[model samples]
Target: RANRDHAAGCVTPVISQNSLISSIAQNVLSINPFQQMINEIIKQKIAPLETRMQQLEEMVQDLQERNDCLNYKTNDLAQYQRRCAFHIYGIAENKEGNKNAIIKYIGKVMGVKVEDSDIYASHRLKQNKQGDDC
Candidate 1:
């Protein structure tokens, strides 16, 4: 009789476990459709934002390329201007001398007739204590 009672007790626990598993499975099945609907709604809301992000990334890339091109052109223009520039050394530093005086001196000493209109601008640079032009 004791052995029979022990066997019945074990069977009771097995039945309770089986019912618990069945209940959990039913709850999951009921929630599956609701979860799927929520996921779909989230995806729908994010789709436009994802597309706009892609477009913004493309715009940023295009702007960077344009900036690089402009920088290259600016450097090229600087080099071209430097090529046309001329520096006259060994000339006396006259604090009172202006652009016209320099042009006249060039015409008299170098015998090169430089027109006033031909010269855009001229100025004496200051020398540092180390004798370097600043």
Candidate 2:
């Protein structure tokens, strides 16, 4: 039937140009205010969360930097403490060499009495390029 109507050139209820424009305008008017309100609400909710996230990131970065600095300081202090410990050089090595004898010899040279108890540990270091004793 519709095909017969088109073939007979009958006029359908064609929407006019004014009708199309009015429909589009009504849709925009109905949706625009609601869309704007939703957008404003979303911005209000997200702004504080974004600010808090940025602050937390900054705090984490600061903590990481402080931890790195502490690690470096600890390493430096450990090296300095090791430096305070003694290393006896140019001493002759003997199979019978012991901690007591070594401490006594060192004390006599340094004009101080060194007992075995005062020595925390004693060992012979491997000879390097200079073949020093420890």
Candidate 3:
């Protein structure tokens, strides 16, 4: 049997060009335009986004607080629909129209109270029994 050799005098080449082509076909192109995109984005867009996000978070917190207050008032109103109490005397606010709002808001919830009468309505909660441990 005669062994045919190339001009370079190479031995039997088991791995040919087809195997290299197959390997290249299996891989995908990973194109990265910038080496420091994340840093640049943080410097450019992220600061504003973080500031706005902080503002949004603060607004959400304010809304939640106002919502809790409104919920409490709404529940109290639902409990007593027929009559309402207006507590006007205690710590009268210096603001002109704020007093009216407070009076009206309170009146819609409870029965009704005058602007000057000192009527005490205390809420006694059920105390939890102390355990023997402490």
lDDT of the candidates, in the order given: 0.85, 0.83, 0.58
Q: How accurate is candidate 1 locally (lDDT)?
A: 0.85
Candidate ranking (TM-score, best to worst)? 1, 2, 3
Q: What's model 2's TM-score? A: 0.63
Q: Write the per-residue lDDT of candidate 3 for residues 1-134, one digit (tens) a residue.
A: 13454623453243555676666765522224353666687689878988999999999999999999999999988777525433233343353445445554676678766352332232222333662322
Error of 3 at 48 (Å): 0.4
Backbone clashes for every candidate come to 0, 0, 8
In the range 16-61, model 1's lDDT, one tens digit per residue, is 9999999999999989998999999999999999999999999999
As a whole number from 0 to 100, the lDDT of residue 44 in candidate 1 is 100
Candidate 3: where is the Cα deviation over 4 Å?
1-38, 82-134
Give residue 126's lDDT in candidate 2 (0 to 100).
Answer: 67
RMSD versus native structure for model 3: 16.6
Write candidate 2's Cα lDDT for 3-71 as tens digits. 998855643334465678899999999898989999999999999999999999999999999999999
Off by over 4 Å in 2: 1-15, 37-52, 129-134
Answer with 1 or 2, whichever has the higher lDDT: 1
Best by lDDT: 1
The true-structure Cα RMSD of candidate 2 reads 6.4
Error in Å for residue 32 of model 1: 2.2
